[model samples]
Target: MDALITEAKNGDKEAFVRLIRMNKQSLYKTAWIYLRDEQDIADALQNTILSCYENIQRLREPKYFKTWLMRILINECKDILRQKNHAAELDDFAEGVHCEELNLCEWKQLLLCLDKESRKIVELYYFDEFSVKEISALLEMNSNTVSTKLSRARAKLKKVIRR
Candidate 1:
């Protein structure tokens, strides 16, 4: 995978495409958590792919490719959300296809209760299994800030679950 990333960074289009394919499911899952409409998710993924390809050379660490790609996807999702000026309701999201790994209603409801940033932090930390430091780099946040947000999000979820 590191070799593929290095090749992609060095102008190998096929390697880049392979890299994208390898992480497509994770990309879609992250996008789905943020955007409700499938078309919106598709558009964001496409834009992220293009942005990543264009900026791959700037990436210093090949091992961070997944997180870097996720950061781009998150930014693209935020751009779409800003353009739309509204978030889709939980019902809209519930009607859509689910991620096989996280199809639980309780978990979905808990996630939906938090604001976007908090929800993203929670998802990336818990679902994607990214460490706080990794998440901070991916989200361009301070590590302490990521830890604080994770703590707050967990507190919020606990409160909601206890109700």
Candidate 2:
């Protein structure tokens, strides 16, 4: 990963693209929690890629590339959310679609009840299988705080699912 980062930093576009491709699933999962619309996720991803390409040289620690990429993606997701907040709402064409037909996962439906921060914490810890310490580093929070939030989020998830 460090080697890839070094290559990307030195203007190797293919290496940069490959790096982004490798983390695409995780990035998309993170974006899904932030966005309900697929188009928004794509937009966020494109913006993230462009930003990373432009700023890869600014990264001082090559070993931390994955975390840095995630940080950029999170920011891009937040930006899309902010923009959507000010945009006029469009009617949902698929509002009547049945979940069963779509094969929507139970966990994804349950996760909708969480607030953004709690949802992010839950996704990172559970779906992505990132440890509490890793989540803290990605989110720039103290490890204790991350652990506490995870506990609270789990409690909230249980309560919601029981309903």
Candidate 3:
């Protein structure tokens, strides 16, 4: 695995493609949790993959490839959110029609009420199934900080959901 990342970092296109294939599901899931809309998820995933390919060499720790890739994906999602005014506007034609259901709409509204960092923590924890330790490493924060943020995020989420 490390060898593949090293090769990809060295500009091996095939190795990069293989690495993306291996991690695509996780990447998409992360995007999905962040964006909720299929089109937004697709756009965020594409941007992350492209950015990872372009910036792979900048990764200082090759052994931490998964976390590195995840951080890239999170940044890409944040970029998309900022670019689109933090409002994921999905077309009716999109396949993964999340907005069609009332339950998903309520969930999305609740998520949107969260500040970006809180939303990110919630997504990384609940959706991506990352541990607090893993999230701290990926986000370059202390584990205690991550735990505190998660608690605050859950409180905020609960407050929003109750409304």
Candidate 4:
């Protein structure tokens, strides 16, 4: 991965493609936390790729590639959400029906009950395997806040499961 990042920074397109391919699943899942529309997800991904490609040289460290990529993707998702805020946000019932067709995993299905920010925090912790401290830094929250949210999200999940 470091080699790929180095190669990509040096203008090697194939290496860059390989790097993105390696992280495609993660990128989509991260985007999905903020976006329900497939088109929005695709748009965010396309924009992220373009931005990454253009700024690969600006990346300060190979080890931070995933973190950097995620930050860009998250920002793109936020931009899309902000742009679409004027539109009527889907209610829980509509969201459930819409998500049903997508056939998400049980965990992801439950995630829909969360607000987008909590959803992002939960997904970053569990799905992306980011530590609470890491998640706090990534999301610009305090570590205590991240831990509290994680605990509350878990409690919510537990309650949902009990129903």
lDDT of 3 by residue, 25-132 (tens): 778877776677778888888888888888899988877788888888878887889987865432111124243344555666667766777676776676567889
Task: Tell me the tens digit of each residue's lDDT in model 2 across 46-148.
Answer: 9998998999998989877877888898788878878767532212211222344333355557767776677778767766667887788888899999999
Give per-candidate clash totals: 0, 0, 0, 0
C-alpha TM-score for every candidate:
0.78, 0.76, 0.67, 0.76
Model 2 weakest 10-residue run by lDDT: 88-97
Candidate 1: what lDDT?
0.82
Q: Which tens-of-lDDT digit does each residue in 12-53 have in candidate 1?
A: 999999999998877887788778788999999999999999
Point out where model 2 deviates above 4 Å: 86-105, 108-116, 155-163
* Residue 45 in model 2: lDDT: 90
Better of 3 and 4 by lDDT: 4
Can you rank all candidates by lDDT, best first? 1, 4, 3, 2
Q: What lDDT is reached at residue 101 by model 4?
A: 41
Which residue pairs in model 4 clash with each other?
Answer: none
Query: What does candidate 1 score on TM?
Result: 0.78
Q: Which candidate is the best by TM-score?
A: 1
Worst 10 residues of 4 by lDDT: 88-97
Once superposed on the true structure, which residue ranges of model 3 sit more than 4 Å away at CA? Answer: 87-123, 148-163
What tens digits encode model 4's per-residue C-alpha lDDT throughout 1-163? 8988999999999999999999887788777666768899899999999999999999998998988998899899889988988532322221222233434466557777877667777767766677887677678889999999899988998898789
Best-performing candidate as measured by lDDT:
1
